[model samples]
Target chain A: MNKINILDKVKSNVTNFFQPKGVFDKNFVKKPLIMYLIFGLLLLAIPFLQEQGYIQFYTMGVFGMIIIYTIVALGLNLLLGYSGLISLGTAGFIGFGAYGLPFFSNLLGLNFTGALIVTLLLSALIGALIGLFSLKVEGVYLAIATLFVGEIFLEIFRNVEWFTNGFSGVKFHYPHVILLFFQLRITVTSFILLVLSALIVIALGYIGFKKYKNKQKSKIEKKENRITKIKSRLLSIFKIALIILGLMLVLQIVLGEPLLTFVQSGNSITTTGFRGYLKLEEFDRNQTFRFISLILIASMFIIYNIVNSRTGRALMAMSRSEHAAQSMGISLMKYRLVAFITATVFATLAGTLYVSWFTSAYPDSWTLGFSLILIAVVVVGGYKSIFGMFLGALIIHGIPTFYLKEAFADINGLPFIFTGVLIIVVILFYPYGAIYLRHDIKRLYRYLKSKIIKFIHLIKQRIQKSNDSEVNEDE
Target chain B: MNKNTILEVKNLSMYFGGLKAVDDLSFEVFEKEIVGLIGPNGAGKTTVFNCITQFYKEDKGEIWFKNKDDEEINLNDIKVTKVINHGLVRTFQNIELVPDLSIIDNILIGAHNQFKSGILEHILTLPRARREEKELREKAHHVLEFLKLHYIKDMYVAGQPYGVLKKIEIARALMANPKMIILDEPAAGLNDVETDELAGLIRHIRDEFDITVILVEHDMGFVMDVCDRICAISFGKFLAMDTAEEIIKNKAVQEAYLGGDDFE
Candidate 1:
């Protein structure tokens, strides 16, 4: 009973961790909690892992790329998974952002936020145009039409050098409007742990004081226990002092940057953080990666909420049976347009963020192959699942770009072949995507557990029988 | 009895290239009445249903339905989606609930138009969005309870018993707060016991929901047992409109069904 209670408490806390209370709805965080925790821990520990030489430093840049693609895939899933519409023009829409941002900010003299807004609007307009031409047709036609749209954008990128700068590529520089990144001598893991404990301590202190004030105060008043009162006051002061100390340490770590002087003069203090030497540029790149990870979480939060709402239901219904959805008052034209625009906007947003990290846009990057790969990412992850898209992006892009590239450096184009084969096999076996791997793993574990229990029972019985025989022999 | 015309169909006609599916048909349904549209296989019964619901654009016709706001509006003038705004909703000949969605989620979809929150607000999960979602969820639960299918609320609509799927469709229609609902082949694949249970369920919907019911079904026994009136059409032409007993006795309806009244 006590164990069950502890488990229940843990489950509730995990669920409440993403509740976004006062901001999000009560049940907004009804996602796979274990996946969230795993991702959360990985993201926080990644910088530290690299700093500690457990991971390659360049992997940060690769993770950023995977995150950008994942955002785009999540948007596409809204179209493909729920609405049953396919848009192969994801790369083209994203190019508009990469090119449009530079054009707006540099050439058009717009602020960064203004440029982003303009980019979103421009993408939406093009998205609507493509949707208008193709959406009237049935399923396969939409795919063919969007493929053409993608080709058209590529041509525009090549010819319209005035906007995209053609094969030369367009450069962008973001001044970091969010103010999120900071370099510290302290490892990220230790810093995060400190912050978490500090928060828990403060929360506990507040709760205990509230309880004492409400119930214990009256008891103390009746007893007239001056000693108890003074002790309680002293405890409150101590709590306040502890909070101040935690804050001071946090400030020192973030700002002052003197953590037992493990800097090693110029060594990265740890080797895996940079290539041979520590540079501010490398730190910025790592921060960009971290910033994009924050973006991944936000996008997931938004998509998860929307996918569980009325609009999502309508889209799913429309995909399954148009006549039923129509009779139920879900407008096909409205919802289809919404899905198309939403998908393109997300692609564009990913592109803009891509520019922030890469600081440049190349026409070669947003080609037909990239668009196909984006589709593969969404499918291989999970079609209608938000969490699956992230996992999909990681496996589809992260593995090939980070690990496979090194593992098969001797063979040219080997990683691409590996990715293609993996996608085919995964789709063949798990048509629902690799997200259902959890279910399979859980089943396997349970089977093993039961078998182990049975084996133990048999062994116990054998030992008991031997003991009985030995006792009879002694008699 | 005061006959309140909740829906009035006038000179409704539809065509399929050269084939006249529904040549010209007319019917009227009173509020809180259970009406059945029945005929032979090629009698254009479903075509008339499609026309009234605006699933197919009629060559010529007027479909005036009394909305929840107590206003008679022409469904022909209204778009297909806006027909539900006038508190007019429908089911399909085959069960059309989304297979992947849970039974309760499938039903909550009928309340799509009831959602006033914007997509952005929903994405953010704002308080208004939360409030609206909570309200609609409660409504869905209440509807599930009414149909006594609350136990299977979390189960997927796919692989459900045929009888349960049929009830789920009706339950979804109820979630719309509709003034009138049209069910197509509500008893298409039910056993005798299920058919009997469906009749009771239909009666309960009519009495409890205080809405008119119009269904296209070939289950004559179920229709005759439940419907307040029966409208018979043969080859896109109206044959008869009366109570079940009168419709059965009418020679035209019998001729339309049994082919020149040659009874065994």
Candidate 2:
């Protein structure tokens, strides 16, 4: 009885210590904005830590690759997850961006931004062309069509000497910021600060919007005087102004010095015609890591918001039942085009980032196997989830390239073997991917918690009975 | 050209190779009326619905619908997706709700055409898109409440009971705010009690929403209990069209149901 009592006391103390604070506890973590902020800070700090010798450069590079692939996976998720359209031609679109970036920058004498825009537009056009052909086919046929398209792109890249530099590939300088007559290099610290600040601003905007929505809901319930209405409106305006001011302050902190230096150092405003006053400058490994991380974070938020909106619902409906979606007046062609274009654009963006990081575009880099791996990422990550895609990318791309490659140095094909095994396991047990693991874990915890509580109750009852017997014996 | 007629199907015909699925069939449905298209299995009832909705291109037909704006639009020429824009929507025989989605989300998909915002607005979650979403959500909730499905609004459609799925299909059709709703075999797999409940719900929906209903059902009792008028067909050929009482008394309909053994 004494042992049981002691055990019960210990358990109660542990439970009390872990009890939620009702607000800003487990519930706060449940909020996506908080999770984004936490992840954003961690991603921003990793590269800096690596440069300071706290982490390896190779590990940082792998992290950078993971960020790049996450953006691609998110874009693919918009297609495969919501729209239910499978494209094995993701690598082809990536190639378009990779090659297009350097081709425009080096040959056409366009700046980085111009090259990026042109590449994105070109990818969209190609995606639409593919989507047009896809309209006539579905399921396995569509998959096969995309596979061939991917091969065709590879062939073009390998054979086109004048445009893609043939199999030799095209090498170019990294992207840079050129203002007026002077070039401004974005240092690693400033880049990290910029990304972290942007993420913070987005998180702040999301929280502010949520608070405003809640306030409006409460105000709707209460009848207000004219003065109160005016006061509330003024308060909302002030809040908006405050958010804008916060954004400007963060931006200034990151880019203020660079802009000041460029302005003071430059007097010549040369006419560059179509290319503008921008130039491409070489960036070190850490700077590239920061840039890719920034792009990944921004893309994650955008894709997350889109998937939660009305457009997402329609796309999902179309994916589930084309007949029903059509009955609801969701134009199959329009939504399909939208999905294809968005996905291709995202792949192109990732490719552009990749070329900027590596300072080279190679036809052999993007292969059929690479495209299949991307699809695997979406499948193992959990369909229709932005964060799941990130997790999937880490597990599939990050773990293999960084962790497993080092751990299993003798095994030449260990990553491929691991990916195949993981895919099979995910398909068999958790077909919904790693995201569904969260639900299963929660259910398990609930079951265990109930059992523990029941056991505690039984122990308490037994102890009470022993006490009663002892009292009776004494009497 | 009748002012009361909401849908006028003129010489509709659909064929597959040598087989005539719908053989020059014509029918008229009036405004705010419950009409039933009754036939035996494989009697081309669903084909007619498909042709009217332009899911299958009719080899020859003219389906003119008087929209909410009182404009007579030819549905045959318009695309399948545009059919709902004229205030005409349909439910499937197999219950085509998005299986993985919550009941409310499935209904919101039904309100897709009603959204005024474009892709940009939806992606950005702009004010217009947010307002439209809230309005549609409230509308979906109201429809669920009316159908007494408010409790299961958050539940996914997968593995749901047949009766609930049928009701959800009706609820989805209602979300379009249609002037007319076409239900294909709504009571196909439902029990007697559920069929009776469906009959009552159909009447309630028609009365409350002030909309017309056209159901293709095999259950004779359900058809008699709910429909004001009945159109009977057999072997892709029209048999009879009259009030429910007259349809029950018609010899041709009885022959179509009892004597039709050639249907495949």
Candidate 2 docking class: medium
Across residues B1-264, which tens digit of lDDT does each residue of candidate 2 receive? 698999998888899999989998888999999999988888999999999888998999799999979999988778999999889999998878778889899888888888898876655555667668767887798889889998889998898999999999888889888999999999999999999999999999889999999999878888988999999988788888999888877878787797834322
* Candidate 1: C-alpha RMSD after superposition: 9.6
lDDT of 2: 0.81
Give the lDDT of residue B190 in candidate 1. 95
Q: B220, model 1: CA deviation in Å?
A: 1.3
Cα lDDT for residue B103, model 1? 94
Interface DockQ of each model: 0.42, 0.59
Best by TM-score: 1
Candidate 1 on B128-239: residue-level lDDT in tens? Answer: 6877886787778778988999888999988998999999999999998889989889999999999999999999988987989999898889999999999999889999
Clashing pairs in 1: none
- Tens-digit lDDT string for candidate 1 (A302-408): 77777899989999998998899999999888888878988999999999988887889888888988898899888899888888888899889988888799999
